[model samples]
Target: MPTTAVDPYLDGNFAPVRKEITTDNLQVVGQLPPDLAGMFVRNGPNPQWPPIGKYHWFDGDGMLHGVQISDGKASYRNRYVQTRGWKIEHEAGKAIWSGFLEAPQMDNPHGAYKNTGNTALIWHAGQILALNEGGVPHAIKLPELGTIGEYTYNGKLVSAFTAHPKVDPVTGEMMFFGYSFMPPYLQYSIVSAAGELLQTVPIDIPQPVMMHDFAITENYTIFMDLPLTLSAERAHRGEPLLMFESDRPSRFGIVPRLGNNNNIRWFESSPCYVFHTLNAYEAGDEVVLIASRMSSTSVLVSEDNQLDPDANIPRLHQWRFNLKTGTVREQQLDDVAAEFPRVNENFLGQKTRYGYVGKLANNPLPLFDGVIKYDLSSGTSQTHQFGEGRYGGEAVFAPRPGATNEDDGWLITFVYDEGSGTSELVVVNAQDITSEPVARVIIPQRVPYGFHGTWVSEEQLTINY
Candidate 1:
């Protein structure tokens, strides 16, 4: 029998798209200007749209706080003002850059959201500050520009090991998590709105562990273990590392709210698999999580995903879990490599729904990629085909707060169209998950592939407007 090879970037290999051009880009502020010339200017083939309300921004720093996004025709106000950072000056003008390539300073330059519920929640070198309702920054550190508090961390370089402070729903205090060692154990902290240290909580998870997504609900903080382990050098230098190991199964675990630090509830497939994305959404009394699991021998790091011609092919699966009761349901997709699964509640029914992207087995051809709309109750699904030359980013559900049914909400996503040489932001009505888009705004420029983004309402930002 002959095996067909698969290419991970099959859809990414498009004709080319027109990019957003900017005349007033930032100047190289470090020692070696030439090498840093285009660090922030280069974009990827796709960008993610995180599931968030209208009060956050994916700031330039790694922090997800008061960042704003809209179609090209809109310009809004925000509380926190974000900019790139600087490294220590070295002799001979050879600036010491941190992380990958040892480039001077870190340049995330873009994030999804900045929560305004608490200000000091985003205090860190590579993090963006959360904003207030009046569009005023509360934690960012610019003396003349919204500098309202000070935050202190144990690590010399903070962004390398920490997530931006997350506000505690019950206490209004900010929370932060840090990891160390090989597989990477966990450390936790609770901070005040003025950036004062409240308390530090530590945990014994494992080393070399990388957390892609986590969630905080009414009862607990959920963290999932991933194979993407970073070397101590990579962790310290802030370099990005890829995981391709086959010895372990990616596990999903949860931490009770300061209840049991040493206890972790993990779930995985026996045949072995990797969970690519983690998402949580709360409905009545239950918290729902959706993840995409892959079973390839190893993750294809380089773009050329040519499998060894004789290697056996693995399947991808999607799983849903009820965090409170510890119940789970797993569903196997027909022969396709499922990558990203995004879940959100649109209808007020007893079940939930999700949006995922993968190839169709019926085609068996390389180019037909599409999105699936799945219902948790009926156990039925619908495929929204994007055909060829199109790629899908993360899907986000934007529902008016307190809305019971998903029918009144909206589903927003990014679709890269190679033929047009552009990535478009598409908004589809949530009621009819498969309906035509209500609004389609072509991003002025082509944004490369990115991790995630957030949507904030105009009223929550502290805009200078």
Candidate 2:
């Protein structure tokens, strides 16, 4: 590995490489958890209560579900599970109340566009709302222009407002990084959880760019920079922003969370083909930014205006950066094309950091995937294979509070089986990554691909809100 002021890029393979993993070999330990194990799939009665507390996925079919896992299986429910309609004001000094209307059913609506990928639904003020693609309201409410109302129940008029907000879990504040289709620029704003504007920080970074994802800590907002060409080409043909790469130096920048919009620190490097995931977790006194970077062929542009991308996409880089120390390290993994990195910790016996990396296969479909355990101190990793042509998403590790570290906790993954042409939401024992998945629940329908998700704690489950 080459070492430099920044981290060195190296050549040798850092870990073992394999071609495929088999799911049949994986052992199924126990029955799925009670909430998920049941045969009866239920939805609504109470319109006031929020849907299932766990992570809910929008399949773009007007079909949304809150997924829960226990004993190795997952169960899902619709967004209308607990929806009550809104009240509309009328002329005769009266109001008209409507009932909960069933959410629209579509055929994989979101997959046509990547906007509804991981981290799509946000839990705010006791309600989990799915933001519509762009500012068009989907599962949530939309207010009319100039009028401010306390609630947005029906499609009727309410307070005019901006939509699809990302709220801070710790502070309970709604936020957004503004996106536009015309000029293709990125903007930022902060709002109240109720969709009221508190601040709009217009930090005009550059043009013709789109924000695939953004990360926020208590102190700052981090945005990954990418080329506008990907979206531009598709726009001409009336399509969603698709794949296009640029040779320009890729950059990552940060600014104070509530400070002036102009305050930003920019750092450039080889283009990150994809910022697969961005997470901020508190490590002692510092907030660390861990990003998984994939190489892009867009970095070989000439001053003479060449159109073709460079020969090959470079190796993947896992980066760690400190906002306070201004330090960044890029670690290169040998043979392993790391993607879908999920961070979690086991606090029972020893407080240790753990991450699961989805390793890609060499096959044409690239369906072969493996799970890796990343040790923070040693900076080394290990892998557990599930099988050939089987792709896994961010693994969710659920441990009972105070359970000993030696006792492997429950690990959940959304596995895609190519042969079945469907996906299974499975759970396993975290301690034994190679062990057979304990509970495997075959989803009734095929789910489209998506991004980040979180497990809602049991204490938060209820429909009263």
Candidate 3:
């Protein structure tokens, strides 16, 4: 008899928690900030049943873990996004669909693939949306964290939505784009401050690629056309459906706000991959983009379908696309490997001095041992270590009410202590990242390591639904 191999992603903190419980007055290790009020919610994969095939980290049902704080008291709750697929699987009592790593199951009763809304979360248009790039967004109610239903902007959103949408702080408009495996490979859309879907424009691309995230500036939106491309023909030829051609050049498409494909300008760079961007801004004659860059990645599938034994690590990098000269200048900003970069939302489309990112560990699986705060203007950074045997996910910035300075806020994230087998929400002062946490709200249950999160202030929740 042969032993089954253990999937690293399905073990340890990456594993899912089954119980859905709500507890108030969570014990605190330190004093909570008086002004810090609202909820910190993060979305990630949590499979409801045993997977039908080989399981990947990205293949799981969407579950949200939220910690709400108000008046120096905190509460914790978690719930599944309850997408159509989740409901169907619940009725079936088993896994009906496979994951992205496997070929599409054309004859599945429910559908070819499941739209597991297990990637990221966004709060816009007076509702919280749990987003999976391959499907439409699902609205989730706050305080209770219950799924309302699929949100289509009154049937205005007819295409898949990006997990990452840029909400312009000054203009109060949300800018996002969607990519597809078919013709009209990409589409860009915008929503007014009041939550109405304004317009959707088709952008031309050579092939269908897995574009996980993009960047936005004050005057323009930048889309990455990397070489990680998808091809049905390749699948028919018994090769990987997605392949990274290192010989090809990575292209950046810069388009003016509400501009069409005709007005888009393409800038080329060496072959690379960027999963997340810190920020982008317009400076003089150039559009500046700051993100974590890698020479190549085995995120989806490698060039030949087999996983690359030596995966590339991403590092802090910068790219300046010169609009006037039609040229690009790129450089590595730091030597340390990091990802899940974030900045103050208020300064998202403007020049920012400080940014936060998770420091990657050398383990074979994905893990963040600490958070690094970078001062871009001074070319310096500070790290907030999670201590020995402690790991954390992406740290989100919680801006103080009426904060005048960019870094005048707190960085909040769920930190899991491996030694104790417990989890706590650690709040560090954004202005002083090297200092100890201002507060630590101990969670009643274990929080598995997950993807992106956001900080919704108490004022934002006051709006009537």
Best by lDDT: 3
TM-score of model 1 vs. true structure: 0.56
Estimate, for each residue in 1-465, the C-alpha lDDT of model 2 and write its tens digit: 986342011111111111111122222345665543211111111112122221122221122334544344444433321111111111212212221121112242322122221134444554444433333233332110111223333433222223334456556676566565444256676656554556655555565554545666666666666553434555467543434455576666777777654688765656555544435544554445554555543222211233444222223344555656766656664446666655443221122356666666664222337667766557777777767757766565566444655334666666677677666666666677777776776665443334444444454333213
Per-residue lDDT of model 1, residues 1-465, tens digit only: 998543232224322222223222212111121111101111112112211111112212222211123222321111222312211111213222222222223352322112122212332223334432112233443212243342333332232224333454345555556655432266655556544565556666665565534555555565666565645465366543443444666666666656446665666543334433334546654455544554433332322243443122333454555656666566665454444454442221123454534433332222325556665455566666553677655455555445656435555555667787765555555566565665554554544333333333322333321
Q: List, residue by residue over 1-465, the lDDT tens digit for candidate 3.
A: 999887777888888899999999999998999999999999999999988877888999999999999999999999998999999999999988988778889898888978888889888867888899998999888878899999899999967899999999999899988999898999999999999999999999999988989998999999999988989999999888877778889999999988989999999999888899999999999999999998887777623343443346889999999999999999999989899999999999899999999999877677999999999999999999999999999999999999999999999999999999999999999988998899999999999999989888897777615
How many clashes does each candidate structure show, in the order listed?
A: 50, 21, 0
| Ten contiguous residues minimizing lDDT sum, candidate 2 | 7-16
| Regions of candidate 3 where Cα sits further than 4 Å from its true position | 302-310
Q: Give the 10-residue window scoring lowest on summed lDDT in candidate 3.
A: 302-311
Clashing pairs in 3: none
Models ranked on TM-score: 3, 2, 1
- Provide the global lDDT of candidate 3 against the true structure: 0.91
Candidate 3 vs. true structure, TM-score: 0.98
Q: Which model, 2 or 3, shows the larger TM-score? A: 3
TM-score against native, each model:
0.56, 0.61, 0.98
Task: Compute the lDDT for candidate 1.
Answer: 0.41
